[model samples]
Target chain A: MTATMPQAAVGASLSPAAVARIRADFPILQERPHGKPLIFLDSAASSQKPVQVIEAMDDYYRRYHANIHRGIYHISELATEAYEEARSAIARFIGSPCSAECIFVRNATEGINLVAYSWGRSNVRAGDVILLTEMEHHSNLVPWQMLAQEKGARLRFVPVTADGRLDMNRLDTLLDGARLFAFTAVSNTLGTINPVRELCLRARAAGAVSVVDACQAVPRMPVDVTQWQCDFAAFSSHKMLGPTGIGVLWGRKDLLDAMPPFLTGGGMINVVRYDRTTFADVPARFEAGTPAIAEAVGLGAAVAYLTAVGMERVARYEHELAALALEKLRGIGQVVVYGPGIEHRTGVISITVGDIHAHDLASILDREGICVRAGHHCNQPLMEKLGVPATTRASFYLYNTPDEIDALIAGLEKAKRIFKLT
Target chain B: MRPADDLSGMDELYRDFILDHYRNPRNAGTLEAPDASCEDLNPLCGDRIRMDVKLHDGIIEDIRFQGRGCAISQASASLLTETVKGKTVAEVAALGKDDVLANLGIPISAARLKCALLGLSVLKRALKL
Candidate 1:
């Protein structure tokens, strides 16, 4: 909440000193990949972990390493406290009233699959419509397709406009008779920031459940599930400066209680009878095995780090960063940036240069140690919407600066020159 | 954060031959009356290629490939067309990832090897028919 950075100087609000201090927190940012300074623009794919997160997991392993819960021993009790407190920390960060409503899964993909398998089967039936958007990551889209196919429900998409924003004018028709409305807070490929709050309310008005995939949004902006009034939200820890292999799925308590266990095993059982077996409650029932104990500790640290940095400042800085990158990229002839205009989007920018394919641009950038993401970004339907095979994306995060954006522009210019583009 | 003095690191990988093949790909159209045809994709990048082989008396009279992908994938596909044009089905069947990589004449990193060998996969699949 201590976001006192200047509104106009959003581009330089993170003062040279402040930027240096923030960059110092992340050890990997100091690394020189391929003997070149690392300009990591692929944070949308996965953010680098700060030393605080690294140390938290290391401290847990060195000191209180034990299986959580069902333990009376001191180390086990401490481990349980760390893990459970991480759940509480995440709940507080996202404005969930209760930590018990959060379920720890492998990643966003697994979390989406869990909901599709558990809730979709029970709530959705034949002739139902599971509505999605064209810009959804494969994680969010493929699961519903499989579930709808299995349940004989029809799959629908809210078309993305040529500007890359969702076609919100058609929401009434898309949400008509829909069992569920699944969407992303931000388009990872096109950088479109959808009206999440309005969309969720409309889904509610249309008598549909809203499931928001905030995998990209939570890291860059302030997301309050209570404010959005969504039924479920999912995101990955790694994308938020934590370690991989751990993700969070927050849902209404009553809904999770009603759904069956996603994966059945020893950890999630209440009784081991051969014939008829009972199950545990809510979060426990959903988390089916030994969980990512250290990764959870690291996630706790990551949330802590973001909290200290202030989400508003993070959002403001990234907005300026996107604006800066878009301005430069657009100046170059033949460079067409996708997604909504600068003010309407996030730090994610996907672009296409004259005849240079995305992979070729990405490879050229790699030579300069400026990491970017290319290809369809797992958004093939969105690719079809954009009418391009693939695009080069430069996604910014809190740690990125204007200088790195300059490097990206320079690298791109070199790519144009090397490829003989006028 | 300047780009290296020269793009030597990339220039070595995007050799003139590879770029030549990429820009002006040879045997890049579908063939009619093909004896055998097969398609495969580099699932990681979504780069797909389809190979059509017109066999005459157990010999490959003509071979062509059609697809869209990265330069390495398209060049590899174009190069494979030339390598297999006058060969027998048995000869083409024996081709593998190494032969394709060597033909491309570049040190392909582990990650991009799939792009380099995508055409070999299509050809091997085609020769099986």
Candidate 2:
């Protein structure tokens, strides 16, 4: 897969020049918010698309805009080819065995819901245990809760340790007799990178299916689904420098083959009958509507861009940024940063300064044109565990710079001064 | 770093009075054996406010609020407690979102509207109960 990608000359680390070039590709970076430079530190929420991705979608719409699969026209054939090629590119990006195993949905939330509705409904019976973690986003947690409630299944959680790592000591007991185990590859709130391969192997040994919420991981680091050996993995394109309205659910070939279709409509049927209809195979069966045509094309461009830049470089650069951020945040006595140590975490940093509300702090930062996400971050359960109403999150990506982080710290200091915390 | 000119807008939003209300909230604790009480949450930030009131002859004799949230929410809650105390339940009920915004003095962005109005919502619910 690496051989197929057009790799650029990437260094052991993303040099300042390399990062500056990457920043130039994103037009949004040029915009001035509140007459200040737009310092986007919210890539974990949704990343800004590069010109490459934007142009890809624009080209698809301008030149070859047509419905896929059914049309026999030239543009239609081209559109279908582009869409399927995007799927293959994404499949290779994630190291999936086959492109057919990749099912495109609206987002990661829809992907999880598809599994809970289709695979979970069939495999999980009453009183079966579904294993989850306390750190799961609402997307991963709510679907299982819905499934458990509907099927009368019991849901168990792997506790988060005090310092925000998963308490793996209780994993054996929790995985015991579990029907399925779904967990995040990275904690969106805590920035804790879970042991994906080990957890998957453990779940397999326990005779339970494994699902990985790769929403945060796929964008930040190198994620090989095959290497993890997880049954299914989901991630969103929007968080990975691609357009919104498209995400991937990479599942095992057998699992996807056996599972019933999630949605039923045109383009997903093999044979339509007056009374009953047969569904299409695997990926096609899951994609029931017209699908996100241009969005998929943009995602492919995003994949190409990331591949050229290299995931290893992105991960290393982001790790450095997170380290820098953690160091600076530590200097601020009022700041209480959440999640594990920098060694155990990625670039996502959640924090609360003094008794300052996350919203108030965020408002102050926004005025400085520093974009950070405040509030529960869709992990209310984790917030409850951390005993904070909300935390202001500053997540980094390949395009972010250390200067932006310094700006964030300065903004935090200003917020403290304004609230008279100084 | 940019000049603090950008933060001038923040000064108005987090004026000294609002911060004062947030830091040393008046009538901060709950009341024992309250005649009416209600709790509500601003789900956006998980900011919660519970309003307890002692009603006598359709009047709010005593009012207190307890909450955990952002400055806008806590300050608004504190300000609301002071405003509604010793007022008729009907008068307090007549207080609308505009009244809360007016009391805050500064213009509230749409994002923080829920935070600013959470106290009023809780108080109205408490009186109704």
Candidate 3:
């Protein structure tokens, strides 16, 4: 059944069945925590793996464990075939025109750096502008800052409204004489699902290349690179119930073929000598050194599992869960929810209690076996702009139930009672 | 909110003295004195502080600070101001690393030790020592 119904009802009816089935699918979620079932609400940071993804990796390692490519051995041939199969799976997931355009890296940060150091450094001339948003994680912002510094290009920010959504007019203003525009499709801290298609259309009109950081978005919603028509996109596997140390960067094949390699190493080369070396084709030119083979396989399995459940269902369920969380936290009255209330937010909810340190509140929650992240969330500039030292963030995923949201409410009540915040 | 009973060992770090200072910080705002000011940050961890020291007769007449950071860093700033307020420049310069470490009485991981010691590092940088 479609999970678009109100969350409280889902908890009472639909979620119990869903949870039973889903919990069985995820072995780790069944573990006891102080005699209580584990409540994982930090999926925005990293998601727990399902058996499908785990078994896929196990099957690869056990059956076809060998160095991929450059070997005529049977295991190597099998390993190479499996590795390329995973690449094709990822390209299909993201709707890339060709599997050759996808480059594998350590994580989303490295993917962004690849674009910044190579594409940005090469294309961006002095006095040209690179547009970004104040809401960006450092991964998307810092590399551009360094590129601007090195290339003598201007790094400009598209102003975010007081309510945390992007100001399209300000983005238009910032795009003047711009070489490229890079922004997050979903803010890690604010939980704003950016209008990426609209932004990309505008960026194209401005003659600026558009790069979407889909690290938070790809896992939560359907991301079709062909439909969005972004020049480049990056996302991490760990954030989507796959293993860490594997990330995907999908760019238009033409753009990727034209750009130079960010790293120089063994696997990414076509030919090398003492004097000069030639790089491989589009994707291999970017993928340097030994790649995370098992992790990529796991990510392929994750893609297959997500496809089975369907992304629209995941999105619908997450939206309901987030609204429930927002309603419950707002009911407390002392907590201030950041971002566009709860209605327009992604699965993340960042909050602060009146006169209580975010870190202290998080520590209190941790004592009750309810884990949440507290700090600037690696966005110090955003924290400064928001005029808060830190915030406590609770993020949800497909596996999270509305019962867990109630449990969170209970935990917060205990925290309030202990801290006398009420 | 205070830590749990199982976190008793952390009491040395989150002592009443430190928590009291954190809750009700002393000289927390910028100093209006004619002394020089220095702003420093541990960029790796995003810890920052601005120290305002008022000097008279080569001795610190008043020391105030203003900034945002974690408990360990902020509490250490409070303790540093208390220790160096009336001390001479030469004496403050002579302050040992052990003295700074003793003031922050917690077992700090190597990565976090640098974050905890940031205030002292800034103080030394200010002293040109």
DockQ scores for all predicted structures? 0.42, 0.67, 0.20
- Candidate 1 per-residue lDDT over residues B1-129, each given as its tens digit: 245448757877777788788889899889887888998877667788998888899999998889888888899889989988888888887778888988988888877888888888888777773
lDDT of 3 by residue, B24-129 (tens): 7777888776466788987654668888888899898988887676666777778888888889989988886677778877655454576567777777777666
Q: Write the per-residue lDDT of candidate 1 for residues A7-99, one digit (tens) a residue.
A: 443542455577789999988887788889999999999999999999999999999999998989999999999999999999999999999
What lDDT would candidate 2 get against the real structure?
0.92
lDDT of 2 by residue, A355-419 (tens): 99999999999889999999999999889889998999999999999899889988998998888
Please report the candidate that would top DockQ against the real structure. Answer: 2
Q: Relative to the unseen true structure, what is the C-alpha lDDT of residue B45 in candidate 3, on a scale of 0 to 100? A: 47
Clashing pairs in 2: none
Ranking by DockQ: 2, 1, 3
Pairs of colliding residues, candidate 1: none
What is the lDDT for A286 in model 1? 88
* Preferred candidate (DockQ higher): 1 or 3: 1
- Number of the top candidate by TM-score? 2
Fold similarity of candidate 1's chain A to the true chain A, as a TM-score = 0.97
